[model samples]
Target: MEQLKKLDKIKVAIADDLDFFRKVLVDIFEEEEEFIVSGVYKNGQELIKNIFAIKPDIILTDFKMPDGDGLYVIEKINEMKYNIPVILISSYAKQDNEGILECLEKGAVDIIEKPTEQSFKASFDLLKTSLLKKIRYIYNNCVVLNQVKTVESKTTDYIAIGASTGGTKAIETIMRDVKRLSKTTIFISQHMPARYTTAFAQRLNSICSNGITEAINGEKIKSGHCYIAPGNFNLIFAGDHIELTDASKQIVSPGIDIMFQSFVSEAEKTCGILLTGMGSDGATGLKKLHDHGAITVVQDERSSVVYGMPKSAIEIFIVDYILPLNLIAGFINSISQ
Candidate 1:
C-alpha cells in the first residue's frame, strides 16, 4: 500500500444537535493529534451555511438533527460541488438498512453506528476507535474529481465492473448516466457488508434503465440486465449461468479478483472495468482479462476515491483505457451500440 500523504492535521467539521454527543466527539478529536476540530454546528443547515468558509477536509454529521439532517448536508455539499468527504454518524445504521443505503447513494463516503442513549456509555471506546479509523481511511483515499473522455465504439456482450470504498457513488454515477443497455449484461463486484447488498441493488434498480438485482446461484445469465455480486459471497460467470461461492476465506468478500478471473473463457465478449477502490483485488484478474482479449478500463487516479485497485492494474500494464467516472458510462454505451 502507498504511504499516507504527508500533510497537516485533517480538519474535521462536525454537525449534531445534541450538546453532549457533540462535546464528546470534540473532546475525542481534540485529544488526537491527527485531527483538528475546525467547526461545530448544531444542525446541517448551519453546517451548510458555513462549510465553504470553514473548508473542512471531512464532515462528520449526525443523521438526525433539529434544523437539517445528514442527508441535507450531503445534498447541499454535492449541490455546491465540494470534494470534501462526508461520513454519516447515525444510530439508524444498526437497523435501517434502507436509510443507510440512502446516505451511501447520496454520496456519503461511509457510515458509523452512533451510540444511542442506552449504548453510549458502553460503546464510547468502540465509537472513538471507529471514528478515528474511518477519518484516516477517508483522508488517505479521497479522490480529486476529473473530467471525462470520449471512447471509440466496440461490440461487447458482457460488462464487468469492480469497485470498493466509495464505490456506491461511483457505481451509481455509471448506472444513472449510461444510456440504455439492451445488448449486454452488466456485472458488478462491489466490496460491501453482507447486510447492504440487497438494498444497494434495489437502489441501483430504481435509477438505472437496465434492471438490477443481486446475483443468484444457478441463475442463467442474460442480456439487458445488471447483476451485482451479493455481499460476502463471490459471483462467478459459469458459461450460460451464474454461480455463487463462499467468500469467507477471501480477503475481501465478493472478491473482485474471483469475479474477473472467472470471465476468462468469455474474454472475447467482455469489457472489464476497475473503478475507485481501496485494494488491489481486481488487478491480477483484470490482467488476465486483458491478455485474453477483453477490453480493459481502469478509473484514473484523479477520478478514483482510493486509486488503489486501478493503480494496481495500471502498474501491471494491462489496461487499455484510463477513464474518469463521467466517461465510463458513455464508453460502455458506445460499445453496446
Candidate 2:
C-alpha cells in the first residue's frame, strides 16, 4: 500500500475536437487518484486560451482538434516557450507517420497510439493505464532536465552507453537534446531479445540526432554513427570494429561486458554513460572502460528504475561522476569538450 502511494499525482488537461473523446479522456483522469483532470478543451484554440489558467502538469491532446491541432498546439507552446510537457495522441502513432516526428520537433515529449476503432468507453479505460506510464516517464524526464543544463559534450571520437529496463525512454531523452559533435560516434547496449532490435533502431532513429541502427556482423564500426547492439548475441570489437557474435556461454542474449571491453582497446578517451535500469549487465563492462582512463558516468540511485547496475559500478569505484539521467548529457559534454 505504501509503495502504491509513491506514484506522483499529476494535473492534466485533455484537448480533442471530438466531444465524446474529450469527455472520455477527462473521465479517465478523474477515475485515478494519482491524476487530476484540471480541464477539458474541445479544440486546440480553447486549450491555448486556458492553459495559462489551468497550468496543468501534462497535456493529453488529440491531433484532430478544430481551431488548432496537435501540431498547432506544439508550435504555439514552443513559440511561447511554455515549460509544460505534452503527449500527443493520434491513430497514426501505430503507422509510419511523420506526424509523430513533427510533434517531437515541436516540443511534444511522448506520442501515444489512440484506438480509433474502439468505442469511447473502452478506449478511455485502456488509456488510463497507458497514459500513466507515459506521463511518469515524461515527468521524470522533466525532473532530469531541471537538473542537467548542458545540451552536448565536447568533441570526442566516441560515446558509449549501457542499460536495461527503462533504458528506452532514458536514451531517447538524452539523444534528443545532444547536438552532434563532428566525427563522433555512439555505441549502446540495451538488453533486449533478438526479436526487437530492428524495430528498436527504426524507432530510436526517429528521435536521435545521429543515425541509429542495429549492429550488423562484421560492420566496420566508424565515427558519427550510433550503433545499437543486435539482440541475442554478444556485441564486441575484435579489431577496432564492431563484431556481433554469439556469447561464449550458452546464454543467448547479447551481453554488455564484451562490448565495452573491446571498444576500450583503442578509444580510451571516450565518454561512457550508464542510465536508469535494472540488473548488473552493464557494471562489469562500464568498469572495464573506466580502468582505461575513460570518463565514466553512472546514473544516481535516486532516479533509477533499479539501482543494481549503477550501484555495483559505484561500489567498485569505477564511476567518476554520479548523476541523474538528465545530468548525464551535460556531464558528457563538459568532459568530452
Candidate 3:
C-alpha cells in the first residue's frame, strides 16, 4: 500500500443517500492507493454544499437521493461554473428513463451500475476497477475548449461525424460554426442513450440554423439537414436513405464505426470527421473511409474532451488532418470548398 501511494492519485468525491453504500465506497477507495477520497456525502445537497471546498477531480453520485438528487447536484455544479464531471450511479439504468436522459442532457458525463447483488468484497472489487478506469480516462483525456477560428464558406455532398464523452458540446460548437453550410448532408452518431437523442436533436435544432432531427428508419438523406443517430439504434445508410437498427446487433450503440463503414460503398463525395470521444470506436471505420478517398478530419488533443477516439485514428495513420476543435470547422470548410 505504501509503494502504491507513490503513484499519482485521482481525487474522487462520492454522494449517496444510504449510509452503508457511502461507507462501502469510502472503504473501497481507501484500499486503492491510486484513488483518494476527497469527500463522501450522504446526499446530493451535502455534496453540493461542500463541492467547491473539496474541489474533487470527478464526482460519483447516486441517481436518487433524499435531499436533492443527482440532477440537482449537476445543476448546482453548472450554476457555480465548476469544470468537474459527474458520473451517475444507479441500481439499474434504463435507456428510456426521463430522469436518466435528462441528467445526461443536463451534462452528467456517464452512468454506472451500483453493485447490489454481490458480497461486499466482490462488489468493492468490481466497482473499484470500473470506477478507477473511468476516473483515469476522464482525468487524463478531458479537453478544454479553446476559442475556435471563424469558418470559411464550404460545401460538400455529405459529412459524417462520430463522437462520444464530450461530444454534445463539441457537436454544438461545430454545428454553430457550420450553420452557414449549404448542400451538405450531415449524419451524426453520438454515443448516447435512447430518449436523450431526441432531446439532443431538438436542442441542437433550436440553437443552430441547420435542420437537425433524430434519425428514423427509411428516411431519405437530405441536403442542408443534419440527422442524429438515435440512442438505442445504429444509424446506417442504405443506398440514399437512412436506416436505424437495434444497436444490440452491433458492437456499440449508435456505433460510429458501423455508420462509417456503411458509407464506404455510397461515398462518392464524403468527409468523415471524428470528434472528441472516449474510445476507439471510429478508428477502423474512419480508416476504411480514408482509404476510399474521403477527407478525414480528427480533433486534436488540446481541444478533445477525451483523446481516445482521435488518438486511435491518428495511430492508424489514416487521418488526413488533425486540427484543434476551434479550427476543425474552418479546415473542413476550406477543404470542402
lDDT of each: 0.83, 0.70, 0.78
- Evaluation by TM-score, superior candidate among 1 and 3: 1
Clashing pairs in 2: 153-333, 154-337, 184-224
lDDT of 1 by residue, 1-337 (tens): 1222335787889999989889999999999998899899999999999976877878999987779998899889767655567889987777878877887776787788888778889999999998898787666655322211122334889999999988999999999866677778899999998899999999999988888999999999877789999988999999889999999777798999899999999998998999999979899999999889898888877667899999999898746776657556766766773
Better of 1 and 2 by lDDT: 1
Q: What are the TM-scores, per candidate, against the unseen true structure?
A: 0.56, 0.54, 0.54
**The candidate that achieves the highest TM-score relative to the unseen native structure:** 1
| lDDT by residue (tens digit), candidate 3, 1-337 | 0011112676789999878888887887798777889998888998988976876767899998789889999899767645467889987576438889898876687788887745656677677788778767765543211111112123458889999989999999878766455677889999988879999999999988778999989988777789999998989978779888889665567999989998888555778899999879999999898888777778878668899999999899746566556545555445442
Clashing pairs in 1: none
Candidate number with the higher lDDT (2 or 3): 3
For model 2, how does the per-residue alpha-carbon lDDT over 1-337 read when each residue is reduced to its tens digit? 0011122567888888777667667767687787888888887888889977877768888865568889888888656545567789887675746777878765676777777645655666667678788787665535322222223233457788888878877777777656665566788888778788789888889877778888888888776778888787777766557787775463435676667777676556577777766667667778778777676677777567788778878787645566656445544444442
Sort by lDDT, best first: 1, 3, 2
Off by over 4 Å in 2: 1-155, 248-252, 334-337
